[model samples]
Target chain A: MTDLLPRSGGPDPASAPGPVRRPFRDLSAEGRGRAGGRWRRGRVPGSLLSRVERRERRWSAGPAPAAPASRSLLAALLLAAATVTTLDLSTDHGPVEAARGVVADVVGPLESGTAALVRPFTAIGDFFTSRSALRAQVAELQAENDALTDQLATADVDTRRLATYDALAAEADDLDRAVVAARVVGWGAAQTFTDTVTIDAGTEDGVSADDTVIAGDGLVGRVLTADSSTSTVVLITDADSTVGARVGSSGTLGFLTGRGEVSDGATLDLELVDSTEVPDRGETVLTWGSQDGAPYLSGIRIGRVTKVYSSLRDSSVRVEVEPSVDMTSLDVVGVIVPKGTDSARGLITGSSGSSDTSGSDG
Target chain B: MSPVRTLVTGAVVLAALLLQVVVAPHVAWHGVVPDLVLLVVVAVALARGPQPAMVLGFCAGLLVDLAPPAEHVAGRWAFALVVVGYLAGRLRPDVAPTALSTVATVAGCSFVGASLVALSGLLLGDPAGVGTGELMLAVLASVVWDVALTPLVLPPLLALLRRLEPGPA
Candidate 1:
């Protein structure tokens, strides 16, 4: 029974003292036997075999090791699959929408409270900011006010004549394009692209998609999202925003794109057709519209081109037009509610700007 | 603390997340914002060991991921939070108490977490630095807020976690 068992598998001291079943079992297993250790007489001894194996391993390996292609390809494929999976899993509005609703419910009041709390801080900030520039602004305003007052005092018409003129003017029906009023409700809160704002008026409120939303002297944005109590008005100066605006006293038609409103140095891009011609600083830009044609909210004042970029090499004007909206200064402002426009719009989820998919100007 | 304390710490993390979603956007500093979730994460990591910190991070990150306008990755935050928690947990307990260290931990967690999120954006082929500056501003403000507020929050939370522990004190 003991002889029937292999020597390595069982205690078999009796069987032929068993060649120990020790080292270098096969020709394949014993490659370069003398390669690992110091050999006496050019032959490897069993005593030095393990050390020889160690040296053999060290000798075989070189530096520029190549990873297995199958594994690498599999890893790359897996990575690609994971990336796509993550994308599919990551980009969704459901959680966000629910969270928004819950957050709005919980945070709305808190925000209102915070807004209230920040009032004191705001006052302090205003004090500091106004202190530095207040003197200059006051002097400028006082000079303008004095000049205007003098002009008013010198050019007083008779009350009867003025009344007659008012009656005729009132009956004539002002033919110039006018903007309707809307209210701001929400901000886009987007990280990269911020060419949108939410206004509290929609098609039901005589507001429609594509109807321009203006704050005061310039365009705030176009109506992208129009709901009953809200409409996301993409601002004109958003990085993704663009408009066809007329510049200067010459009414030069040019494309006004947003050139990242950085710090107090907010600038609008005014790309003009004629490279030779450049808009002057403070040249007002208005939405190119009809003067007497059907009341299609046109010729609406957009902004004043502040800094014209004419490097003599760059074709585009890259004019920095300061918007009339005074983006940061606005607490509440007028949103143009163009007349005859329907406010009743079906809720379109995720589709932006109704007619124009890409909401920016060409 | 005990294992029970650890679980309670997780609940506290959830509570903190809810508070963040409900309140952080409103706490404006010069119209910039703070990240409340990051604040609580650092706080917990400071109080607990790495395992518990990782758990707190995961739950908090998931909650933030579940928050609005942020719906894409439920697990990415888990991955990020674990990393933050692991790293922060390794800090000396004494360092956790200091205002500077507290703010540093919060800022670090927020930076790491937000950077991880940007990785997702990069995968989608969006431009690099998308929302990063805003995220940084938000983290910076939150760190300031954490320094301002964590001292107020940490002791009470630690007491609460200790009390929640099932075993003897």
Candidate 2:
């Protein structure tokens, strides 16, 4: 029974006295003469023997001589990382920002190239995920197209209405303000937790920080930082972002705050200034332009009021809004450059009539 | 590390960054993308031990911090990944690794990395106002995604790095 159990001592079976019948696999193929060579050839593969030899070498080496130096190197790197974090947090826009800008500029073109390369693959993914929805949309669009074609056949009345509609659209779009068109080259938060995107256009293209970004559908976001050829746009769905909004036709003022989500079900929270005024469901929300239109432009459609909750304790209403633009599938966007100081004069004179009409039509 | 190996490491890091920036968002499950850079860093630690791994982690983290679309303070990822690399390096097994142990190591390192980032954000006051629950959720998601990705990324990466420089011979 004792012979059946292998010894807990070293690999050398010779040290143990009388006829210890060791397993063939347990014997090391070193210093055992002919029997070891026979066992090695018959049972253990060449690769296994080499692996065991390597393990033995590693065990004999104990700790590598380079261990202390590596430890010091790790400490130094950790300290450097800490220093960078402190500098970035404490200062407004310092050397770290500059370094970040440099990195952005370097990586921007590469990102855009990769995005273009991968667009078709991602589109295929989207197609499979939303195949049923796409089919429904195609049917809806086909019906709409047929109706529009029929309207076009009655040219005279339709043409006049179209002219009037185009005029209204131009005014609502703030046509006087310059906009730089750009493609969204990258997505995800990168290192930060905020929801953001990288756009191809930047300061070189007259895009700058605090500029309003918009898609064809509605407001997209605001530019947070601009490099020479690229910029970071903080989406409206980012947790820290807030846009002043005008609710319904009454022009009741409110603030739309992001909840930091970008799924199809993501929604913004609207807090009305007048808590007693309950906004009806489906009321349209539009941007109440900021001072000088730096961060957000006025009259742009934000979303519709999906749900409203009346709070008993504070007597305040919490309204939920589904954004007009799909935050998850951003593509081409425009950065609204604040018209020069000279254009400010034009805005003031044209303000009164436009501001009132900017309400629900958007 | 030899110059050729260093170059290979640099190339791998750059490729991981590009993938994270361009492809990650498209592949995000519930708005959480796996950290490819972190996975690569951890893999390197497992392959080469602590010193090279920390250096690679710091460099990779700094790049991630400075990458476009990043809005928070820089170096947060750098600090987080440095600790991740060191701990992962220390966790390296002396014997040949089984698949289960490798998966466990990747999951543990990923959890620690995600937790450190959340903790740093909490201490420094995240502007996003992420709550404890949300932070924990993010950490959990990161771990799940990374662990899921380990089979696809880690084995190929480990094999490649091992080929680049044979272990401590």
Candidate 3:
């Protein structure tokens, strides 16, 4: 049993080595010895053996040093990446946008080409599905036109009041702003970075960063970054988006923040500034307008209040508002550029001219 | 590297980029598009070495950021891709990986890549960054897509790379 156990601790393995191990000593003498001859295949030159030993020692020491050029390159790449991300996030408009513009100038054409190529297939599918809808839409428009024409005959008595209202409405449209029409060319890249869209009209078309974007219905978003021939718009529903809004009838001031998309629907949270002025359900929300109305213009419809909640801990009133425009189907939109000092002159001329024409017809 | 090999690598990267930009949106499901550029970079990194891989990853990421419709903060993807490229390059193909290992590499790299993007964005105070709950879902989805696409992408890419470069073939 003891033999089967294999001489346990008979000699410390270190001291019980069969041949005397002098690891540090020169092996040349050992290599020429009678016993070492069996292990040695041939008489290797001392210089060659020493070289091999030295090479092994260097390798066992630790990791090899990286080339200075490679280290510099890595550091440079990291620095560049960090700088760009910081600039893009911090600045409203910057060189990052310019670089994107240049790339967009190249990529936009390719995208258009692809869209043109694929349109026929999409058109064919839409043709089959939309014929009835198109017919119904045209009939509805015709009926609306006929009704408006009949109303025009009885408008003389109310012409002055209607003109005042028209002037007010026009003023609400970013103070009768000079508008530039743009078409949505693409949706936000990859779904991970959501709630943005690209438009074909860009800086050259008098569109600038922070300009207000709107569809026919209501506010869409503001221009996030602009280039020469294209611009990116961060939609009102983007997670990063927030607009100062006023609630209906009462005009209670609040901030509408994007809640991103949920399974039920895409929603916005309207948190009142006063918290005491809690908006009721179904109250319309409109942009409260930032100073100069740069990003979000005043009177742009945001949404209507759906559900209101008052938090117990913070005493903050938060209301969930469903967006007015269908974010999923944004196509053609317009950028609102503020008119110059002549805005007042233009408004008066337009309103007076409309009133005179209405009075004469009556 | 030989000029021909360099040119071949460039052409491959350009093609991958074009495909990603031009064709990805049409095929995207639930806002998640399969990242072909990531797949191509990792495959190249595994076949090549870390040095060129890092540079290539940076270039590809930069292009994606600068291209139309890339509205997120610039350099976020570049930073993420560089790290992924370096990691993938570490597993030099001295011996061929089995199918299981290949799948693991794809999943692992994709997970790391997505996490890096989220983490870096969060660190930078990027408002566009996804919430924590959504981040996990996005990473998992990215991993699934990457793993599924890897087999189709990597083998052919490696063979082509070997043919392009002088020493390997």
Candidate 4:
């Protein structure tokens, strides 16, 4: 700000700038007439000078600040208005498959089916896990199953697969009951081998683009594009799929971005931008929250973080992740529409959570 | 020229664009999103022959850039879509482009686009961490979307084109 100072000056401009006091000092210009004229307007100019000085002080303290306060206020008001308008623009949420409401309907069936189908498989796979308790549980399930029929006992195995399956089941049920559903009507003729799947849901279905789409286990991908009655779903396993996540048990926050496609049981890497909490091999990765600009809903499971590595440049750890769902065989899915736009940060988190990015603001 | 036919086609195009904006968003493959702009071009070309398709493609591309964050040069998209429209015009509506073909086209185009974008880093001697694997996944996602949804749009659009053309069945 002082870059504007001259090489040599008659008066110290910092204490009293020339722009404010120039007219008074320049009275030598017209001698008597100029001095007499200045006397009449003296008080007015002095007050105006004080006002200008105060403004300059504020201006010199920061760069391009006036624009942001006013702009952000305007943006806030506009965002508020948009949110209110969105609230009223409710999705009729009809049962027809032509729109996204079917997504709501399908979420329940798909999640439960996924939970039911994948539970036993993951459990049996985990049966040989190094834990004796796990082996004992499997043994108990086998003993229980020996007395029952094979089909009847398998449902029991789903029940006995440990808390992970239970969490998955409950989460799946919640996803089913709490989402919008869409039919797999239009597949882009060319790009069918992708993590993205287009459905017959759209903005009119109350399904805004960018809402997180999920299944029984947890996060998949968010809606990147939308139409009136159709949208595209990007799966979490997509190499480019990235979301802000946290270790559910540890609360260690980080962004979990997809590494690449898994091949032949090989693990896909999930790079973490932070490592405040060292995520164990088995800790569940969950979305941080909508407040952090999550593309998906809060608490939607993404995957379990694995293969931890520390980067030399930063303190954060890089890890591998496996999405909760089988990207290869997705049949139906759920769209978790963000509930409301007017956040409770100001109203709930109090002054602490609403801190600005810069501490320089006084 | 029939004003009715023109209006109908215009409506279809608008609907497609609007749907692309509103509906097609939910199904994107993270950063590797499906190209609704590309989809509209391919469908229109398959439906209404070439010259008209090229014009429509330019318009759709512009609309895409105007999406959430409007672009400075909508004209740039006009260039890309014109090519997509022209190439699609040459392809047969009768044959289905395979999942691989869609991936190949999108991946090739995205690679070129990505390379153009990478120039921002290159000039500064800071070549970006171009996640080759992730981008390929995106290309694959685009292929999946294009293949899965083409029929839904193409069948209706091709039929509409037949109706507009002065020919005997």
Candidate 5:
């Protein structure tokens, strides 16, 4: 009663408390006996409780623990991964590169064998598909031939002059360097996230990185990476691929970048040097080449200007150019091996669908 | 992991990598192909635990990085797949998901994986010029392909994994 009364401003309960609030273990024997055990006395079923307990146990089982050795091994592997990535990205050749070379050596034969096995089936399919395509092509060529026949009669004298220039160009191109013929073994998959192709020709056959690769139509791309018996070519339509280009009759200087894919209906982006000078549509584009014509020759046909637009970043004008070569159906191609190689002086040919490298230059 | 199980896993991974390199190109549309290697990692992680899944992921990634036609920085795929393997391993408690749910998981994980790959490439300042828009498109297409192919790939992979290590469950 006295504790319940206010002291100064409030009552002091602790002073007048009859039972102290102590822990269960600290409670006096009489207090412990008097405390209610409601949970034990509850009417909950033993079976239900057991079930719940079992479920809790099952659910509470944490993930499996890895052995210490494995953990250490994993840590070591991760560290090795970091080191390998750094070495691989920073330089060309390393232990990782040696491993890659080994993989290429081992897997290259398997890939080639698989390709050989699959070619027949694909060829059959292509044969069926090309039959209809050939009919349409024949009709188209027939109409073009008739048009050319009339034009040829009228321009016989001019044709001879153009033929002479064409011959001179081809001779000069061949005289400058020899082109190696190689077969397209495989195309880059979506998993690779690159627009590239693998060819059977490699360093053993004089194919090296940064060499110019082309098809019968025009400029295909350049060699990206090469193994002893295999080489990877980054197509001109690859998003990362860039080539110095000359646009139209005036040969306006610009550079071409790939749009990542050809089947997706993407076009090459051509950024010209002078934004003020916009090239007309239908103008031919050619490779301006580097200083020594190593990767790209001075007069390789690239594409043609289709549309023109203003540059977003600078005063230079940007235009959309359509690649002249049909990138999707590259079966056979040529690798322009520069002069001064240990291989044959003329050309080092590899697995080829046909020998189309002799005459075709730009 | 038993030696046989490890060997079988290795063989499966090598087969998937081979398919990715050889057969995937034939079916690829618009520069997007299903990530068969990632699918293997996810399936194995779901069956097995994180430790093995992550190690396998690292090895698979390294192979992809070192493989020919890979122009980007090495170990990029390894890093991305490791994250995916970890995420997939987090679902170990719910080991046996429904078929539809499994499809969803693959698609969802593929999106995360692709985005992670793109982000890593961006962080590394990819010299290959993988643009954001193009990468996004590739990711979307990849998710579609992964979802479509999950039914075919996941079940067989899960069965083989189960057969290899029956004691885990």
Candidate 6:
């Protein structure tokens, strides 16, 4: 390695025939010729002597006797790991889940603290990367705001009609649930074959498993599990996730499956139950809601269709959707928790029939 | 290991875990983040040898497996990292290694570790398993990320560990 270094003002020590040494006077030889020569008058530096001694010791020691011990340790650990994996895979609600919860509880605070410290830098990075997208969003919102203002200006002439519209809007928005707000604190490890995020909220904050999570734009995912102070949310873009979806105003029903990619314009695959019904590009998709809205709330926007493909092996059509929420840069999110079983039942009674029909078809 | 060395190792592992969970995701490229803990394991192996590396690898792997937001079965990372730690430790030289050799070992271990985890997930019937093409892409991405990060992560880590332990070369 020293040979790789540029030469200074002298010959390279590495290229010398003998060991490199400092050009010091031969004081030990002078003392040897004088007196009894039993002891040298001048000696090598103590540090240098010790370094040479250490080198000799290292050479004598050779490979340490720890090789066998380490081999045995490796074998033991591998076996232990295999046991844990088998135990975890063989049982549901096993000790592994409890241990995971404990680990999460311990690590949650540190993750959130680190996230708080690091968020600003990440925001700065995001600003630069998505500046063009942000500008486009601003323009789109401005146009929408202008259209809404025009509608408001003409509303006074139809006060009765406006009242009914307001009532209908309230009804549509009413899921009889409370939203618990949280910030994303961490994400799944790179090795884990799942797309998930950790949020700084849990059962204590009324964020429970199966509750619907959403960002300002649209649906994010559902709470997979909750510890005391943190919860894991399996993203809608996870391979294992599936959401019942309704296509545009056509009401064509289907199920959306995640493609498991999120950073680079990740899209979900929407498979319509009625193979003959074709969805047009740009049609919006929304969650049709499950019973009691446990996993997803009805009317929450998912995304707009970008492309449609007809299956070569079957009559089914596959619609690709870019999620309304950017799964890559999640920040503040809301978890929708049903107020109570009674309230949830009351809210679901009217729509239960239609939902059941859609569910059956899907 | 001495108690002080053990404590320092634990601290470093914990810090790596925090960074892996909090910072890695934000820096991900194309939906893949570098495995910081895995890199730490390799660094430990290179500096301390096989025994300590295996112990650290197992413990750190368990922490990663059980960390929040992890949806797959536990211990897959543990198993994979143990093998990586062993391989990296076995590659350690009697003399200090050159920079090029160190980087190559890191890249090789990263590839092996990522592939092991993915293959184990597939063998265990993980629902999150992707198709072969996507799996290959993810593994390659992780290797690239780990190699890119070695210069930033490994040198400082090796320095710190050598300071703490000061073992025979």
How do the candidates rank by lDDT, highest first? 6, 2, 5, 3, 1, 4
lDDT of 1 at B80: 62
Model 1, DockQ value?
0.04
Model 3 TM-score (2 dp): 0.68
**Residues A25-130, model 1: lDDT tens digits:** 1211232221121223234456476565444332211111112223333334335434534654665545434443464344333333444455466557667766
Q: Give model 3's docking category.
A: incorrect
Q: CAPRI verdict on model 6?
A: acceptable
Which window of 10 residues has the lowest lDDT sum in candidate 5 chain A? A24-33
Model 5: lDDT of residue A280: 77
Which candidate tops DockQ?
A: 6
TM-score, prediction 6: 0.78
In candidate 4, how many Å is residue B71 off?
A: 13
lDDT of candidate 6 over A202-237, digit per residue (tens): 777767789888899999999999888889999999
lDDT of each: 0.49, 0.75, 0.66, 0.46, 0.69, 0.75
Worst 10 residues of 4 chain A by lDDT: A59-68
In the range B60-102, model 1's lDDT, one tens digit per residue, is 6655543332324344555566666666665523241334555
DockQ of each: 0.04, 0.44, 0.21, 0.02, 0.19, 0.47
Task: Please give the C-alpha DockQ score of model 4.
Answer: 0.02
Tens digits of per-residue lDDT, candidate 4, A139-196, equal 9779757755654555543344345446645443433322565544322211212344
Cα lDDT for residue A263, model 4?
Answer: 31
Worst 10 contiguous positions by lDDT, candidate 1 chain B: B65-74
lDDT string for model 2 (A1-362, tens) is 12223334434544443214433212332312122132332234587776664433222212121232267777899899989998998888789989989999998878888888988998898888678878987997899699768866874655654554465457555435655778898886522467899998877777778988999888999999988888999999888999999875556899999987777768999989888888878677888877767688777888889999998998979999999898887888887764342221122223423333223210
True-vs-predicted CA distance for residue A328, candidate 5, Å: 2.4
**lDDT of model 5 at residue A140?**
79
What candidate 4 keeps of the native contacts, as a fraction, is 0.01
